[model samples]
Target: MGKILITPRGYAKYGDEAGKRLEELGYELNVNRSGLPLSREQFVESAKEATGIIVGVDECDEALLKQCKDLKAIVKFGVGVDNIDLDAAKALDISVGRCVGTNSNAVAEYTIGLMFAASRHIVAAGCDVRSGGWKKPTGVELYGKTVGIIGFGNIGKHVARIANGIGMKVLVYDVFDIKQEDLDTYNAKSTNVEDIIVNSDFITLHVPLNDETKNMISTKEFRQMKKSACVINAARGGVVDEKALYEALKNGDIFASASDVFTSEPPERTDWVNELIAMDNFILTPHIGSRSEESEINTVNKATDIMIELLENHD
Candidate 1:
């Protein structure tokens, strides 16, 4: 039996039953154990004999795909497929499947959590408390604040619904047109990106990463935002420029910012990420927007099922 390569660090740990099911199907599993995403060399070595792969953030570019003659299918463990070279996979007749909306609610909830955390200075307050200092920092209320959501997709829609439930006015910005009925359902108003940038009290990004969206929020956009505005990005890394974000925070161009993704995962300590990490107003998370127990299990199991189905069909 050919092998299946599983590259997600949290796969079996979060979805152990699914892993056992795959093993019972007689496919040899090559699980990644390094805790970090596999390097190109490591991926090539591990996947050369694999008929299917369920990947996390590993790069599966054209060059890598060309070398994997045995690979028949690739399943994205989460919503984003930017890491995989779709054109190369299609050219090679390899099936690609992604678990869409598997983590939408989880990411939405996390985005809202970031909003409250940043607005209330929760992290700073906790730190002060730990140091035996007593102080009540003034914080903005989410109620009646304007929340701008970029990308009216599954995650964005959820965020809007939650924001509305909390009495926040929702403004949505997306390139594609959204139906008025849908907008009315959430009490959201469709607006342009420029309007959202300048008018929103809390701006949250939910767009995918692509040529059009890379650095979508940079120096110019930051400059347009109000000084009291807070920006939250739980979307893909590189969507918000880390360097620009650092400068904006340092210079008080904006009130504060929170990011769950960065240009580099587990970012190196020497870069602009290091400087951003030291800022009191800047909050960062280790891309755990979709790490909720329910989301993790759903994504892993769904990816596993897709890989198994594709592998079986390829035979």
Candidate 2:
């Protein structure tokens, strides 16, 4: 029987049906029972004996890939493969794939929810109610507001559609070409990042983490935004500089911000992160952007299919 190492607790929580399919294929699964990502030592040790790995946001670097002698595939449980070293895997002859479009709607919807949460102070107000306070915080409506979307991929497109549905004007930016017809369909205009940062009442990010996008939103970008602008990031954490974000919130450069992704998962509780957490204008979620019940199961099934295909076709 072949061995497959599975990380990502969310998958394990919702993967019983998918799991049975893998078992039927004669693959013995070694899933991470710990709710946390596997530590480097644990990953290398366990992955060394496995023919394939189903991974989440955990780092899969060249060094780890070199040590996993039996590995033939690294199938991403989600769309972005930023956490995995694609070039290293290719050079090492390990097939790598992602469950594309599996979680786009879930994440896009979460992005819209974050925008609402920030614009309406929904989370902070809820906290106050639970803490025995009844102060009604005045919040802004999303209608008739201008929303700027960075990275016009699947998630971004979904966000644009939702924003349009709510009577918001959409401005989009992408490094690649965005067809003008598609923009017209969403009632969105193709624009530059600077225009988005300066003019948008709400700015949302849905880009991959790469050389061009790392720290894409920083001190300068925050300064360029309207003082009442709310920023949302449901994309990779590194795309927005946390330090700059803290400063922006502290100095009132921006009215409010929310993130579902952080540079560090479950953030390390650094002084900046702690301060951001304490501020009423900031919101943080534990990376549940693509974690709706429906999406998780969909991701697991697609990831399973990829793993099966790779293992069966491997020479």
lDDT top scorer: 2
Please identify model 1 stretches exceeding 4 Å from their true place: 33-40, 312-315
lDDT (Cα, tens digit) per residue for candidate 1, span 1-315:
678899998795776788787889888888887767778788988878888889988899998888888899999999899999999999998899999989999999999999999999999889889999988989899999999999999999999999989999999989899999989898999999999999999999999899999999999999999999999999999999889989999999999899899888888787676888978788989999999889988898888888888878874
What TM-score would you give candidate 1 relative to the actual structure? Answer: 0.94
lDDT of candidate 2 over 1-315, digit per residue (tens): 679899988777988788888899898999998887788788888888988999987789998899888899999999889889999999999999899888999999999999999999999999999999987999999999999999898889999999999999999999999998898888999999999999999999988999999999999999999999999999989999999999999999999999998988879998878989988889999889999988888899999999989888888
Cα error, residue 313 of model 2, in Å, equals 3.2
Using TM-score as the measure, which candidate wins? 2
* Residue 304 lDDT, candidate 2, scale 0-100: 92
